[model samples]
Target: MKKEIGSEFWTVEQTAEKQHLFNAFKRNQRFFLSGRTALDFLIKNIKAKKPIRKAYLPSYCCHSMIQPFLDNDIEVIFYEVLIKENKLMIKVDPNVECDLFYTIQYFGFVDEQLDDFIRKIKQQGKLIVEDATHSLFTAKAFHTEADYVFASLRKWTGLPGGALVWSNETLYAPASKTDSNKAYIEKREAAYRLKRRYIEGEPIEKKAFLTLFDEAEQMLDKDYRGYGCGQEIQEQIEHLDIAKIKKNRQENAAFLCEKLRFCKDIELLYKAVKQDTCPVFVPIIVKKHQRDPLRAFLIQQNIYCPIHWPISPMHKLNVGTEALYKNTLSLVCDQRYEIEDMTSIVNAIIQFFERK
Candidate 1:
């Protein structure tokens, strides 16, 4: 049978495992419509308590990440990031302090350098917010000294609408109750249909599933900051198997690296997994000329890959950011797939280059 490899998909049982995993990180976590929504809410609360004037963020990052601060009138200072030996090294001027310093566990690889960087920022008395969207499955997932941390739960799991914001201390109470709003109703319906088609051998068109999934996603795209996730979706998060999710992703990523290391047309952006690392996807820098063609080929084979992000109009003006944006592509290697799935992806990738 032909296979379709896409985003992470989960069943009732799986989402249950996720809830258990989430509880392990912190006793309290606030969920929102999306990561940006959660982030926007958190920033607003932080600003209310302290005068946050400027933010230092990596030069190469998602546009959504930049939106919250800019919308609130916080100055954004871009820092250089160096990629060497399959590691991302962030270069920030320790002396040039900002009210808030943001860092990412890029593709789940946070080495000693990143650890020291986080330490330095904390020691500097800067309010830190670590983006753990890519490293949600790691052991030390919420182990941060940062005042606030937020992650895009939908990125790593099958849930249609949810993001989480948590802190080390009981800074404030989360929305005590989840509501039964229209967005929640739509997401639950679509998710139910998609899960049935995915796991129960239901005869449904691929487009049918996608349309429902897209509809579910659109529900979360609205600016619903400070809103809590629905009870239905929250329950879905409870069943996710954190350990199994981490193990599968780590093994699959390793398999892809070992299989495709010889490809000259692409460079593995991250290769090694440290103890605290749990990759969400396999990232590679496709040769500029071959990038789009490779992406097209993968889609043709029903193996959809996505560019980490397309540069925003503002970021496109930056030389480094634009180059990184155009070159980076992420292959889905989440816990949803197994060895056979990865093997097929590898074969298709190799065939694409062989024919080129």
Candidate 2:
């Protein structure tokens, strides 16, 4: 199936947790646990043990990833993506006074600053959960003893559900009482059927429909009601092929980076810095306003290309939405695409802008 692994939803053919995310959809009847969303669970796990009032956030990221806390009325502070090579940058929220702060290892680079930041926060008796949805495999979610951690399984493992993984056992998270996860199961089947259809050429209206197969069932995360982060697509994040998937993704990323290095239009996406390897998604900043025209051209050629984000972080806080899209685009460069596909995408991109 044409994987939309870029948007944090994946096939959960492996485990029950994965199925919960995919099939459960938003009708979270299953673990009506004490905490609702992943962020809530994270908050409860905070060392304070009291209500988590505040935390840090990636200026540019999937808003839904942090929605649960906001839905439950937790404070979310904003931080900018530092160009300072792997070091996380932050500015405190006004009048919000939150001890807890969180940061993401974007592109999965687990830099020294990330560790130092966490240590500094924990020293003050706060919390930091490494949001590893994007960089799960690259940076070990459980690597450092950050109070709590969570990964969007679908992003890397391609599972459906996303939640917290706590290191300190003292943290609190009540066990869910809700039984019989019918909704989650149903969504899983829906995803599976969608995949089967796309694979069998089952009459999709457009190739774009393929990406929505997993995204359609996402739950609106309430954390961003203040600014509108988005809903979590608690789809089936299951069936982690581990070694094979990692190998495929890493190889694909390396291949593209090497071959497309000279492509004038496609700017280098992320710094490939993982020591182990196995990367799948590749992002790029396009050179011109040719996103629509170029994308349309690629589509006509039966080449499926898509942008990754909706809004830039600069615009998230009403700071500066001007650079919202600029040249930012995320094209599918996973294991599914072969060398020929990469070549086609690269040549098409270069040719499109080269003509300009």
Candidate 3:
């Protein structure tokens, strides 16, 4: 028997109340189609206010992280993030003055040191745009002092699409455009149908539904017609329970850690979980040779783990980041999983290494 802890679809009844979720955002908050769209909105508006020649971005970030800045004709300067002696270290050029800086609260784990670093950058009079994509369910999401903060909400909720951009100070968003989310809705529906067929042992229906899902993805990739989130996604967020989501993820992560801590072959990336942090996933590091084998074993058991990001040529020379990219595995521990699922996942990993 196999159980999957990720990839969820929601019915209308599962949606949350709008007022409850919308109330979380202040008057200055605005929604966008996606995080990249929000980033584009922020950069365009910020440039309109002041000249932005150079923007400091994280070197160990995804390519999409730098795309918006480049699209805005802003110079992109990469800064280094190193993991030294089990502690995260970040370095930036003090002499290089930038109009803005972009960074993230990686994996929802924020410490006093990270706070201090952000403050230090603030002291340098640089406009900071913090990406809270992974930290949306954490306490730091609400308490950040950054000039602009945004996140892709689709990652956390059962919504087809949504992202939010907010600032303590007033910032203008791009004009909105209306478009249909028919493709997005269909994609989710197809996924649900596919799963049902799989459970019923109907191979023919399963294949048909899978093809429907693929077609939906292709349509979505070609369709970026809307400027902001659709009404459906907005309604979904309204009904969601943020606190419970955070609690479930935290408990599930702790449960998995407790079960797997004694395994010698796996190294937990961050052993100590902070009370304030809402973990998105439990990350582990393995020998380079064991990485693919372990990933394959989990896949065979219907346990899906993701690589945080692919390593690029730039990362190859940076020993710390290169090692992390090559060996790190992010185990899904989102709010969807319970103790039983976490235990099953842990047992699967232990069995894999035991046979190795």
Candidate 4:
């Protein structure tokens, strides 16, 4: 049988190369248990310096991205993100009152229009914070003029818990000690090990790892405290081949864009991969009625794709934004897979539509 195409990453084996991943950063940086914790640390630091009354955020975002601001008593005002002719456009009024502005590099593709919007707001003395979770591998990840930048490393690699918060200027020390969620980390580590064994043809049941992953995710959700990176996870980061990973992701994403161009009932969010982009996922917008069905069908073929997000009911989104959320699906095109793997993904997606 063919190996599963996509899901959670498996743990990386110890390698002789010690590239020192953090050394690439020219700014002061701190590690955290997850992206949310990193963002929380930044939020508290900003609050300590000044009163943040209101912040502008993109409508297409995960709840974790918004929770840190809300926890600090900051009001969140979401701006619209619309797609036309397969390009993403930002709609925000310059006259809106906001103390802070948050931006994202969606799916590792830089939106030039959003950058211009950020520049316009920055000129007005609005504090800027960028979430680089999806764009960590891209060249634009740390080149921002934002006051703070943070990314969750776990999304891109096989680490139990890893994230980084950085700034061009000195960052204030975290107020609290890093969280010691031993159970959560241990469960995720176990899941990674089991997944590696399963991929290597071990006589293991898939449910074993899946259950552990779910438990770990639940534990993480319940705990909102900030955490520092553990020693072991840091060591693993040092061994990563950052350049190779970026190259693989770019090639795979480019291949998918070409292969999926003619797919019926599916629209590629990005028509071409930019020179500097290292895509986290090759996102596509499906017909609203077929999105869930296509996702279910892919899972049956041992290919797992994730929805970009499921917005909370608390944020009453407009009809256009709501439709975008419902129809969008993030396809796996990370470093884990190569051309052959991506071809399989394309074929599976084609098969799904042909059956309809």
Per-residue lDDT of candidate 3, residues 231-287 (tens digit):
767666667777777788899888877777777887777785677778888887775
TM-score of each: 0.87, 0.72, 0.86, 0.94
lDDT of 4 by residue, 1-356 (tens): 33888889995534578976655667788888888888888888788888899999989899888888887888999999866665566787766899988889899987777767777888898888989888888877744678888899888878898888888766787537655467889999999999888999999899999999999988987885666778788777777778877888999999999999888688998888988998899999886469899999999988999997887864658987777788888989877778999998899889988887
Query: Best candidate per TM-score, number?
Result: 4
lDDT for position 225 in model 4: 69
- Candidate 2 lDDT by residue in tens digits, 1-356: 45322333334334333322223122122122112354555554453456666666756666565556565677666655532221234443323357666666555544455565566566666655666555556635433556555544444544333443444445443333222233443454466555556655566543344445444344322211111111233332233445455666676677667766677665665645355644546666555566678877776666665564566332354333224344555666665546666667767777777777
| Candidate 3: 10-residue stretch with minimal lDDT | 8-17
Instruction: Score candidate 3 by lDDT.
Output: 0.71
Q: Which candidate gets the maximum lDDT versus the true structure?
A: 4
Task: Choose 1 or 2, whichever is better by lDDT.
Answer: 1
Model 4, CA-based lDDT: 0.83
Model 3 residue pairs with clashes: 16-238, 16-239, 16-240, 17-238, 17-239, 18-238
Off by over 4 Å in 1: 8-19, 22-28, 82-89, 173-181, 184-203, 215-219, 274-276, 314-317
**Candidate 3 Cα misplacement greater than 4 A, ranges:** 7-19, 22-27, 180-189, 196-226, 312-317
| Model 2 clashes, total count | 26
Over all chains combined, what TM-score does candidate 3 have? Answer: 0.86
- Write down the lDDT of every candidate, Cα atoms only: 0.73, 0.50, 0.71, 0.83
Cα lDDT for residue 186, candidate 4? 93
